[model samples]
Target: AQSVTQLDSQVPVFEEAPVELRCNYSSSVSVYLFWYVQYPNQGLQLLLKYLSGSTLVKGINGFEAEFNKSQTSFHLRKPSVHISDTAEYFCAVSEEKTSYDKVIFGPGTSLSVIP
Candidate 1:
C-alpha cells in the first residue's frame, strides 16, 4: 500500500515570507513523489516530482522539495511567498516504473498568504 500525509492542513504566512509545507509517505515498493498545486476553482498543476536523481528537486514558481528516502518525506519549500501563491497543495506518490501512473494524493494543505 502507498499513502501520503501532509501534517499541516492550512498554513498562513505573510507576503514575501518563507514557508515550508511538510509531507510524508509510506510505500511498499519503490515510488515516485510529487507536489501539486491547486488554485481556487482550478485544476491541480504539477509543482515538482522525484522519479530518480538528486534528492533536491526544483519546481515552477520558486518551489522546491527534498526527497528524504530515509525519513520517507518530501517537504516543499519556498523562500518567499506572494498572495498569488495562495492555494491548496497536495503531496502524491506513485509506483515507480509503472506502465501507467496512478498517483495517490494527500488530503491537501491550503496556503493563505497575507499581505
Candidate 2:
C-alpha cells in the first residue's frame, strides 16, 4: 500500500517572509515525489519533483524541497513569499513502477500570504 501525509493543512505568512511545508509518505516499494500549487479558482501547476536523482530539488517561483529517503519525507520551502504566492499547496506521490501512473495528492496546505 502507498500513502501520503502532509503535516500541516495551512501555513500563513507575511509578505517577504519565509515558509516551510512538511510532507511524508509510506509505500511498500519505491516512489516518486511531487509538489503542486493551485491559485484561487485556478488549476494546479507542477512545483517540483524528486525522480531518480539528487535529494534536493528546486522549482519555480523560488521554491525548493528535499527528499529524505530515510525519513520518508519531502518538505517544501521558500525563502521569501509574496502576496501573489497565496494559494493552496499539495504534496503528491506516485509509484516508481510503470503499472501505476497516477499521482496521489495530499489534503492541501493553504498558504495565506498577508500584505
Which lDDT value does model 2 have at 45? 96
* Per-residue lDDT of model 1, residues 93-113, tens digit only: 998766236889999999999
Candidate-wise lDDT, in order: 0.94, 0.91
TM-score of predicted structure 1: 0.95
Off by over 4 Å in 2: none
- Which stretches in model 1 have alpha-carbon errors above 4 Å? 97-100
Q: How close is candidate 2 to the true structure, as a TM-score?
A: 0.95
Tens digits of lDDT, candidate 2, 1-115: 6788988887889999999999999887788999999998999999999997899999999999999999999999999999988999999999887438788888989999989
